[model samples]
Target: MSFIALHPLRTFSDTWRHRYLLAQLIKRDVLLRYRGAVFGVLWIFLSPLFMLAVFAFVFGNIFQSRWPEQTGGMPFWLLLYCGLIAFNIFAETVSRAPTSVRGYPSFVKKIIFPVHILPVVPVGVALVHGTFNFLVLLAALSWSGNFHAHALLFPLLLLPLLLLALGISWFVAAWGVYIKDMTQIVPMLVQMLMFVSPVFYPASAVPAALRPFYDYNPLGTVIESTRSAVTGQSIDWRAWGVALGFCMAACMLGYAFFQHSRDEFADAL
Candidate 1:
């Protein structure tokens, strides 16, 4: 008898090996999200603009908030939007991961599909949303006269966060199949995480003792660095390096776990 070996490296290569299929899945996922809306795909562009308007009204006009040490005269809402873009990418991807696998029984029981790739669909969809949000941020910065060449680095700065989200998605998607309640629980945790991360607030706003925790958080570090990229401030390369290392490890481990647990998926469902 002959058997195939599934290594951690194979997890990544398989995605690449089936890149076309993955793209189709991602495209289908994005279309399905806004399928019934009157605006259709236009929501992808309008949704972020609406959120930015809300943030401007609440934080800019209502609260009149400001960063502890504002950079380059950037408005409070623009600053908040930068961090929110990064956090939203992570939040949206992870919150939907549980449903990615559980919601599609045909992919698992009735077809010869790469079940692992299903978790990636959410991350891809979130990236599409985040890209639109980033463009809106650039337009706001340009209108406010805060746009900079460094803003181009925003996409590169978010690479680590993307990896981390992909990792978490794989883990949660696997568990969600066996434990149905995970779908309900993950969104709450993600909402809590948004507050804990440096989205609405800056790390400087945190107490001195708790500063170290923010310093070590991958999401926080990514948010801070992404903001820096947008505001043309000096990025903390050392911190980004640490986050990159952690996210790489997480990606590998999550893929391994998913592959291991997937064997029981058919039986679980």
Candidate 2:
């Protein structure tokens, strides 16, 4: 049996053709998370606020953390939270990706389904939650008297990250069907990545030997650029441009890989 085309053009076409189906899937995924809870959809807003409070107490109160050469009047926790907004978009999407496809055996085996959209669903849900988190961040910044017009660029600044997260999600979702270990391993790696990234500290604080790696890391670059946008600091467009190019390439390659391996999914699942 012939498999789906591996060309990036075909992948894009499939996505656009099934956009409505993808939308319903994304909606279902979001609602399922809160379906039984008394808090319901409010958790989308409350969850991140609770996380922010925990981070603020642990880092701001206990460690007395501050960004290096911290120039903005923005509080340390808010600064930390700004970078975290970008990271969480990526982290939350990737953390759930492993099961995006594997968790849907009925979709694979019992129906003629466009399974490629399964991976995209997690990223879509993440963006929905991330948007709520961004709003919360904006409110917090306004309260702190550090709000800026540059914060409006926050969604644009996240484009590279969205592309990057989608690419990685597709790859891991496919691999997860074959390797149960991926479900466990991906989260740990995500946690490790959060620490290495400039979420808690400035990129300047990293040792000289590791600076190049941080600069080249697409996730780190996006987080830093996003932080700059929120803080009214100048974003490094050159670095962001490079990250965008790399992320586009990754998106294409990941789509190709997922399509190529998808023919085996019915048997595997």
Candidate 3:
């Protein structure tokens, strides 16, 4: 068997080396999403805004939701949007990961293609949508006079999440190639995670007993930190640092697992 380096450096280098192919795949994925639509590429901006309107209305208007950790003049919807966007990035990526590689058996069969990068494509696509969502968020915050320079830290906060999502993507994408059940299982997990995470409520609302697990969970940590950034509050760097370390290990371990199982993908597909 050919040796596959599982180091974090190796994952970064492999991704950088295939930057062009990754770009093309990302482009294709984005374009294909709105290919036949009347609004075409415009929906990228509209889709998120539309959803935000619905969520804001449902929660901010009807439910009149107020967060336990509410700060400044930030409205309920904006608070929800801030954390929701962070969670959406992870959810969007991992939810699609299962089919990222399995859907394209041609790439797996092609000797010249790099199949290892398939899972990474979903992360790229998620970032694209996330960028637009962030922009929309900034516009909303600025309009509400809640915009702060700290909001710039939004992308910075997502680093750990992107890493965690990518690692899980690789592991799930490979399993999906063989098991097929991951398609159904992964989304259910994502939905369950959304409710448990701080995407809707503030992490402060959780009781002291459960606070540690909630904070340590990379998913909840990112969302909580991101909300802090948007609200111009202090972040628990110690917790953020721990989450980053855990996510980095996940990325490396996931890469290793994907490469180890690479030989079997051809047969499975």
Candidate 4:
């Protein structure tokens, strides 16, 4: 009898071993998204800018929203945008994970492929979008005079969320191969997460009784710390360290789950 190896180390090695293929896939994934559009790839740059304007107008002007403990009097939209950028990366990646494996039957049945890397493709694509959003955020921050030197740490701070997103992506992508309904269910959950997360509001605004739950939410912690990085507020390194630990463990577990389940994908599909 043959045995399948579930070693967590293979996750990194598999990804590294196929780095060129991954890059080509990611590039194709990105270009294919806007291939037929009139504006083409320009939409990538334009779409986020348009959304930022809408957010600024709706949140900053219409709603009259304000951060609970805002010290710099940063525009509410700017604060909201900071958190949204981080959340969007996770949300976008996970929402697409289910379809990632399900959409590519050829890869599973007709050819030899590293299906484990399929999940990472969504994270890479989302990061591409997130990168554009971050550039826009920096422009907004600079325009509003809220840019902080600490914001340089923004990418570093995103480590945990990136790991978390990749982990969830792997788990969902594998499950999506077996359970067709996951494609629908995962997006709905991502929508609910947006509300539960501190994206549009501050953690400080949560009621005291509920604060503990909010504090423990890894997404909330990342959002808060990310906001601090943007606005020059003090970051909770202790909390971030804890989140990083959790994310790393989750990433490994997710990779293990994906590898263990992949053997059945060809038959299931």
> What's the distance in Å from true for residue 165, model 1?
0.5
Q: Candidate 3 vs. truth: CA RMSD?
A: 1.6
lDDT of 1 by residue, 1-269 (tens): 00122344665787888788889999998898899999999999999999999988998889988888765388899998999899999999999999898888888886578888989999989999999999999998988899999999999999889989999999999999999899999999999999989998889899999999999999999999999888888999999999998998787777878878887888888
State each model's CA lDDT, in order. Answer: 0.89, 0.88, 0.89, 0.88
Clash counts per candidate, in order, are 0, 0, 0, 0
In terms of lDDT, the poorest run of 10 residues in model 4 is 1-10
- The clash tally of candidate 1 reads 0
lDDT per residue, candidate 4, 1-269, as tens digits? 11233344655787889989888999999999999999998888899899999988998789977787766568888888888899999999999999888899899885578888889999999999999999999888888887899998998999999989999998999999888899889999999999988998888888899999888888889999999888888999999999998888788888888878888888888
Per-prediction TM-score to the true structure, in the order listed: 0.94, 0.93, 0.96, 0.94
lDDT of 3 by residue, 1-269 (tens): 12355677888898889999999999999999999999998999998899888877998789987777555368888988888789888999999999999999999999888998999999999999999999999998888899989899989989999999999999999899998999999999999999999887888889999998896798888898888889888988788989999999899888888888888898999
> Model 1 segments beyond 4 Å from truth?
1-9
lDDT of 2 at 128: 95
Using lDDT, rank the candidates from best to worst: 3, 1, 2, 4
Instruction: Give the distance in Å from residue 52's predicted Cα in candidate 3 to where it truly belongs.
Output: 2.1
Query: Which residue ranges in model 4 land beyond 4 Å of their true spot?
Result: 1-9
Which regions of candidate 3 fall more than 4 Å away from where they truly are? Answer: 1-4, 69-72
lDDT of 3: 0.89
